[model samples]
Target: MRKRNTLRQGFACPERSTMTVHDAVHARRTIRKFTREAVPEALVKAWIDGARLSPCSANQQPLKYKLLMGDAAAPLLPFLRWAVMIAPQLEPKPEELPPAFVVIAVDTAIRAAGAEIDVGIAAQTIALLAEEQGVASALLSLRSREVPVRDALHLPEQMMPALAIALGHSAMEAEAVPYEDTHKYRLDEDGKLLVPKRSLSEVLL
Candidate 1:
């Protein structure tokens, strides 16, 4: 008999789908509700590899990732504000919280300023890779929550938490629809998230 893949045996490795880049882009959404199923730490780390290879400004590569899972991730939950547009309704319940997260931190010691572009690129890379692996993801900007996050992670003074990407198995479905008067997402009667997106024609010009 052939040897089995040990990584799959030890962790909840969801089979990678045959999702194209375009498909992943179209299917990707900000998932607020996630299943309690534990996300494999190794798998989440692998997504960081994708971000590692992302382009950085002047190759400074100031971005660093901090991985959190299960209990370690719980502390940061209270500080994180989810789905501000929908507030409490879209906030994940205790049972629906993401089991893992990749916090992107900026190493100010290296290149403090002008790292925003690199952060965006790296974040999107992680999100797309997670989506391809049948994992749900939500990219969260720390903003006012930065202090609590840094404190919770015990990050060094030189490292600042810029963004957080929550990862887990999705408990709900969300779809991007053509934009109407307002470009706000809403939940349908079935609890499915309806995200309004501008059409290519409207954006092309």
Candidate 2:
């Protein structure tokens, strides 16, 4: 009798990959203190590619991305607010400024109802992808800076700036700390960035 061919049954084992999606997810931290080291353009493009494939509301994909670097990133710096929770101590210094930025704009011509959700997913996707590339990112809402950002970027009236993500090599460290009565994050005396997260029990209900 002929033996059954296991190869034809598609049972081949795959080689081990460097890092899993879960690794990238869990390792991701909001990095505000970035090194002066410039982020390669190719890495930024890869992050944007990942963001573009993120799940969208009704497949409308209403998000538009604008990549800024060098001089392009400087004009938008004043518009960005960092470490508002800790303000003076946690605010990034001149040398720690991010070397690149991506402005996620919402196209008003598309359905606007779910644009917020779309932007949220896309922004996180970009951040996570950046982590995989050994780059760091800070996702900024750009609320008060929206108008100025629009003017500086020369965004069309039809395009509304939803968020800005700062990216570069990180110069500082951030760690998740246990949650307490107040869920606000603060810096330690040593100046390490600390983030407070809700306890599992507090979130499950």
Give the candidate number with the greatest lDDT.
1
Q: In model 1, how many backbone clashes occur? A: 0
Residue-by-residue lDDT tens digits, candidate 1, 32-134: 8999887678777777988999999888899999899888887677667688888889988889989998889889999877788898999999999888877
* Candidate 1 accuracy as lDDT: 0.84
Alpha carbon lDDT at 198, candidate 1: 92
lDDT tens string, model 2, 1-205? 1111122233322223365678877777888888888776656766788889999988998899999986777767777777778777766888878889998998888865558999999999988767766778999867453566778889887778888999888888888888876778877888777888887787896
Instruction: Give the candidate number with the greatest TM-score.
Output: 1
Candidate 2 weakest ten by summed lDDT: 1-10
Candidate 1 residue runs with Cα over 4 Å from true position: 1-16, 143-146
Q: How do the predictions measure up, each by TM-score?
A: 0.91, 0.86
Clashing pairs in 2: none
